[model samples]
Every structure is written in C-alpha cells, then in structure tokens.
Target: MPQLDHGANALVGVMAAFGRFELQQELSGLTAVQAWNLLSPFLPLSQTDPMAFTELLCHGVTPAGGFAAYGASRALAELVGLSFDTPAAQAVLDGGIAFLREAGVPPMRVRPYEWDRWLDTGGNVESWLPVRPPPPPERPGITPLRPAETRLVAKLGAEQDSNRVFISRDGTDFVAIVDARYSDEDPTRARWVWHRASTLYLLYLQVGRSLQTPPHWVAAELEAYVPLPAPRF
Candidate 1:
C-alpha cells in the first residue's frame, strides 16, 4: 500500500494549483482526456487546459498519483544526493516562505502564490501594474466581473471583481487555485488567484512554501492509486 501521509502533499499541491481535481487517476484506468473531463467543474475557466500542467503532472494515461509521489521523492533525493527526503523537508518561518530547513520543521507558510519581496515593500496594486489603469470609475458601474461567479457576489460592476484576479488583455496568464477543501461543493470555495506566472514562479513557490509533509495528505481521487504493481518500490 502507498502511504499518502508520507510524501503525497507535494504532488497534491502542484496539481491542485492547476485546478486538477482528478488527482486519484491511475495510468492503467483512465485516458488523459477522461481525467481532464472528470475534473472539468473544478477548473475556473472554460479555456483550454494549461498546456504543460497535465503533462508535467501526468506522464501517461492517468495521473498515477502514487507513482508520482514516488517520483517526487526520487527526484528530490537525487537532487539533494541523499537516500531519503527528510533532510530536504521544507518549513516556513517568520512570514516569508522557507525551503529546506536544517532545524526542526515548523508550519508551512501559506501565502498567496504570488507573494514576493515586492509585497514587503508595501506596494499597492498600481505599483505592480504591467500597464496603466483607467481613471477612477466615472460613474457607479459594477459591470466588471470575475471569471467565475461561484463565490458570493457582493457588487455588481466594480464590486464584483474582488473575488478574483485580473490579467492584462492579449497577454498570457495562469491562475493557481489553492486551499480548496470544498471539492464536493456545487461551486467550490477554493482560493484562487490570477497572477502573472511562469515556470520560475512554480519552482519559486514549490521550494519556498513547503514544510514537513503532513503525516497523511488526503487522497482526492476517482482512480485507485494502487502501489502493488510498481517494480521499484
């Protein structure tokens, strides 16, 4: 049996960011598109699935999470030149993110995925805009809206966008959803942020925001993650 409590959190964290809900899929049971469609409601956008997300997380027919965790540990151990991954266990201290810790592991730092030193400067929205903003609303209009109406609507026009993040027009962007425990809700209350992101962004958060792996990271899956078949473990 695979111990989800041991090393599965990292895989869950990564896939969940991309709104991948079918984390339990097995390579032997489901096709890529089947798993993708199974997770359809969890995604915030009807737009095409992220180009590399499913690929990076899923190598073959399904996600095969159990195997993925084994792979994560294998990758981490190889990277650190160790037989096990405890030495590279991640932690969080002071409000900032911490990668591998040399001391007793502390709690994980859960920040908005986009948190950075720039936030330490106490910058406002205007400070980080890639483009200029329009002047204050000339009239009372809450026409603008978030990409999803799943959450409660406090305002109609300008007041509506608060529940979501906005990206520039004609530019590429990614939304990483996190802290979403509401997998079964009609409209999940998972926290999501739309930020300018890249591959570096993923690595940056992956390293900095980790802490001790939970004794057991819950398996959110539709496929049986059986480990009895793998040759290495």
Candidate 2:
C-alpha cells in the first residue's frame, strides 16, 4: 500500500515495520478523539478522502470503530502471525484501561451480559479488550505469571537437565515448565540456542560436538547416545 501524507496517517505502512516501543511512543498520551483524529481522515466516515484506508484494516478493526482511540491504539498491535500482544504496545493500552477502571466505569449494578456477548463464543470484547487470561496454578519455587513485572532473564536447565527447566527473572525467582517447549513443540519446533554466542565460545574452544546446541540432528548423532531403560522387575 502507498503511504499517505497526513502526519502519522501517512506512515501507516511504516507502522507495520515499527517495533513495539516505536508504536507505543507514536501513541503515548493522546486522548480518544485526538488519536482518531489521525485515523478519521482514512475512515469510511471520511468519504471525501480515503487515502490511508489500509491503516484501519491492519489491526482487524472493523467498520464499527467502537472505542475510538482505544480501538485505534489496539489496532497498533502486531497482527502478522499467531497475533499475540506485543509487550510495549500492550503496555500503553493497558494503562488507558487502568485509568478508566480506577474511575469506576462499570458499576456493580451492571449484569455480566450487559458487558459480555450472549453466545459465549470467546468474543466478549467490551470497551477494554484482549480478554485477560485466567491465573496460572499456584506452586512453590515458581513465580506466578502476574504483577506484569515478570520478565524472562535466564532460561536455565532444571536440576539434571530434564523435561522441566527453570525460567528465572534476573537470576532470582523462576517458574518451572517443560523445557524449550516453553517456546515450541518437539517435532514441529526448530530451536537454535545461543551456544555459539557467549559462554559457548569458552565452553567449546574448538568446533566439534561440544560446541553445539543439542537435539539438532535426529539420526546423525542421536543414535550414538540412546540409553535403554533399566530391566523391569
């Protein structure tokens, strides 16, 4: 799509290439009306000049454009593949919702259906969006995925390098989960760890078996390390 010339509106395609921080900074402190001011000229509402039409379409935003600024801000998310919320972009949106929530936007008198859709098809998008996931199970030695402060600092092998691993924050608290499976599955997943980046240079001085991240080859080297189970009683 061609770029428009209306301030940020002209940079619609540019938004696609921008990282989360750039996008967040692009829309940090704008009110709902002000934000859409950049969007309106390209909207159907603006029939006179429909230049940057694709901008409105990129984020799965429909013709409705309900929550205006919030909707447009959300439309800044990464919509390429799997469509997970990018950290920086999500931060700005969550801040706006937090402000409204503190203002007591939803009174207790309001029923669930008043906010949620009737059919329960996972589309209960109210003024706030990206329905929050339920809390994870509580367990010791593993920090709960809450507080929004959790960050992956180090992914260390669990005791014995087993199916489980310790994903820690700043080398301190950690949560145990199935290994790189935290990123992807076994057969379908293609993993390339940083074995050749930092410590790998020291641990493996020469280019040989020791200088590699394991499980890359199926039969070339895997057959040499298979351990049979102990005889059962």
Candidate 3:
C-alpha cells in the first residue's frame, strides 16, 4: 500500500480509527496498525498540495460531499491527534481544515438517499466544519428569534406519533428540544426535539449562526418566523 495516493485508504483508515462499525468486521484479524501509518503516504502531499489532498477525500461536486466533508475532516483531525507537541500532525490537520473552508458550503440539498423535501434538507451539511466560517455581516435592524418566531420555525422531523422539531432559531442554532405533548390542533409534537449530530445545523454554524439571509428556505422561514415589530410609540 506504499502508493496510496488517492486517499480513500486514508479516509478508510480514519473511519476505522473512529471505530466505524462496518469497517470492524472487514478489518478484523489484521495486525493492528496505527492511524498515522495509514496516513503516512499522504503527509507529504498534504504539506505540498493540500487542496489536492483534500480532493482525494472530498467529492466536492457530488450531492453527498456536503454531508461527508466535515466528518471526514474531523476524523482526520482526531486521528492525527491535534496537540502542540505534534506540529507536523497539527499542520496536516490545519491543511484539512483549510481545505474545508476553501471548498465553501455546498448549496442546500437533502442528504443522499433522503426524501426530496425541505425538512430533510436540514440534515445535509453534516457537522461543524473544522474551522469557523466567517460570520455574516451585522445588519442595523437585525434581531434574534423570539417566541413568536420559534413557533413558526420549522420542526426537524415530520408529523408522526413522536417526532422532534426545532422550535427555536436562537443562539448557536442548536437549540435544545423542549418536551411537550403533541396534539392534532397543535403542530408542535410533544416538543420532541431530536438532535441530528450532522446536517444543516452545521449550515447555521457555517454562516456564523446568523439567520439573516439564511442559506436555505427552511432557514429563511425560521428567520421569517418573527412577527412584524409593533409600532414604536
């Protein structure tokens, strides 16, 4: 495996390092190798041609690429073990993070294999990118989500016996779920908030957590959930 230039092997190695269950069965009985050993062939490439290295793991133009980038980058970062003691490892980790930001956020879409609908789109962005996406510029009149707005903000899951929805668009945008009973008349179902570890919630983080000019309609709707301001006396 000396000429492992394509990086799928490195990605797979990272996946195994992270204990991906599927890889477990396939990799068993093999002499255990360190994640670094798997990534060794790519280290020089990462230092000299980081973007090319990124392209090896990232399928930039594909639908699933958005969903995969952060997880892949984070896995690489963790496998490398980010610490000052390991500057070489840190540089490699930094390169991966740089590649993610350079690639930018993909246009909003549902995760591959998901139903083609907006609610499902929330799961597309996957995870918080390794670096902080620059914050959206502050607008003079911009305000945060309010109770009224939270009520209108779309819930994460569809209507079912017990489904979770995002009831608020405040703070970092990963609002905690509130438990309440669901009713036919009330669209809010038991305030059942399911935390999707990956998805457009990452999109929120990508845009620096601003609702103004959201990246997608669901986000726009969440932002628009606010009521018109009362006339100031």
Off by over 4 Å in 2: 1-3, 6-28, 31-33, 43-56, 59-70, 73-120, 123-233
* Local distance difference test, candidate 2: 0.30
Ranking by lDDT: 3, 2, 1
What digit string (tens of lDDT, one per residue) describes model 1 on residues 120-219? 5464333432222222334312233244423221111223222331222123443333333354444444554432344323322332222122112212
State the RMSD for candidate 1: 20.6
Q: After superposition, how far is residue 54 of candidate 2 from its true place, in Å?
A: 6.1
Report how far off residue 123 is in candidate 2 (Å). 5.1
Candidate 3 or 1, higher TM-score: 3
Alpha-carbon lDDT, every model: 0.28, 0.30, 0.37
| Candidate 3 C-alpha error for residue 116, in Å | 36
**Against the correct fold, how does model 2 do in TM-score?**
0.20
lDDT of 2 at 36: 49
Per-model TM-score on C-alpha atoms:
0.17, 0.20, 0.30
Model 3 Cα lDDT, one tens digit per residue, 155-212: 3333343333344444444453444455567756355444322323443343223322
Top candidate, metric TM-score: 3
Any residue pairs clashing in model 1, and if so which? Answer: 5-216, 90-211, 142-156, 142-157, 142-158, 143-157
Using TM-score as the yardstick, the better of models 2 and 3 is 3
Candidate 1's TM-score: 0.17
